[model samples]
Target: MCSILHIIGGVMNIAEIGQKVAQQRVALGISQERLAKLSDLSRSTIHHLEHGTLHEIGAAKLFKLLSLLDIQLKTESEVTKPHALEMASRSASVSYKTTISPQELEESLITGKIEPRTISHLATLIDELPLSLIVLVVKEISQRHKIPPKKIWSHIYSWANQFKSPRLAWQ
Candidate 1:
């Protein structure tokens, strides 16, 4: 998954922002042509966005695009710092039925064990999980998939803030 900041960060370069937009559009199952028609942007613009070559897109258009895909961009000023995560005990684990061991999951959460290639898949998975399970799954995937701990935590923090609930349920 693209970083939440990939779209929301004020300091992101054009290419990075475009990539985020394209990624979310794809995730939402919209084709470039369809997105162009919906956003009233040119097909060439959509193509450029997916290709990360769009020089400039207006803020309204960008916001509309993300909104259409169910992404809400929030600046740092609009969000608060995250409180510490309250993880569930191992006995109260959420069942993903993956081959990963509980011990491995615990270790990864403690010591950022990210595997880059798996980040996108993990992001997709995390999106569908209940809020109670998201933190654990993200931590597990980030550690096993080798994603940067700070980056994954930022995504979780933003999500937690968006939902107006910093506390996650494990049971």
Candidate 2:
């Protein structure tokens, strides 16, 4: 289980904090566009922050982003001595498998059997993967769910389009 932490009192650096934020976001399978919408920040701002190029983030926005990522930035005095430097743990609870059987995956998707709450997990699992891999998965999904691959592809495309440039809210 990967987790992100930010120690505010003695270890607060803008660049490091940005990296931590990016780590948390990716671990959550969240895209920058989604993070921006949830935090009310611009995609460029999210990009800059992830790349550690943004400085002087406002407190409200910072809080919003951290809260959305399930991150905790704590002061030194709030914690005990030995663990005083540690921020609260926000673990990526989803356990992702490297290879899910097509039938199982199809059934999971059709029956809403995924552990994570969002359907974006399907996109995340497929993103940057090979075409053969995608085809195999899609074939199973189509066969089990009785939906054509063309339709599934359309939905995936629409979701990708939305993710590429997310609007003001979760769609």
Candidate 3:
């Protein structure tokens, strides 16, 4: 099975972690039985872990499985904020005639001021940007502009309503 896993808020939920493990095991051409034997775990355990059916697993066992699969977990503390902001700006600028600058986007977001020209771009951003990037951008903007995160979210919610954004995150 193929799966995509996204870690948000510096954490991977259990299902995503399981999907990662399954991806790595499949990439290595390792069967569940072989993986169980190699990791000194039961085949049922491996199956449950890969299928995300297991309720909980010990850290040592998870670490051993990941070690066997050569999967390393990483946390992006300082790196993700700027990258997400840059990505958001780039996403907002994907227009034909008018492009919204990062500063303009930030100002608009903070002050609830949407320029007429950038409305379409902002709507596209609201509709298409990944939820994680949206969350990161909101967090960065809130911290930098001294606006409460709730206020920023309210602004986004208003934009989403005005634009009729189809994205579930915005909805």
The candidate that wins on TM-score is 3
Clashing pairs in 3: none
Report lDDT (Cα) of residue 129, candidate 3: 77
Query: What local distance difference test score does each model get?
Result: 0.55, 0.60, 0.80
lDDT for predicted candidate 3 compared with the true structure: 0.80
RMSD of each: 15.8, 18.7, 7.6
Better of 1 and 2 by TM-score: 2
- Clash pairs (backbone) in predicted model 1: 1-120, 113-143, 114-145, 114-146, 114-147, 115-145, 115-146
lDDT of 2 by residue, 60-167 (tens): 898788877888876563232222111100011134434344443455444544534444445454344434344555555666567777876665456556456243
Model 2 stretches with alpha carbons more than 4 Å out: 1-4, 8-11, 77-171
Residue-by-residue lDDT tens digits, candidate 1, 75-170: 653132122122322222334333333444344345545344433333333344445354545555555667766776665455445445424431
Worst 10 residues of 2 by lDDT: 84-93
| Model 3 lDDT-worst window of ten | 1-10
Q: What's the TM-score of every candidate structure?
A: 0.39, 0.41, 0.61
Model 1 — TM-score against the truth? Answer: 0.39
Candidate 1: residue 100 lDDT (0-100):
36
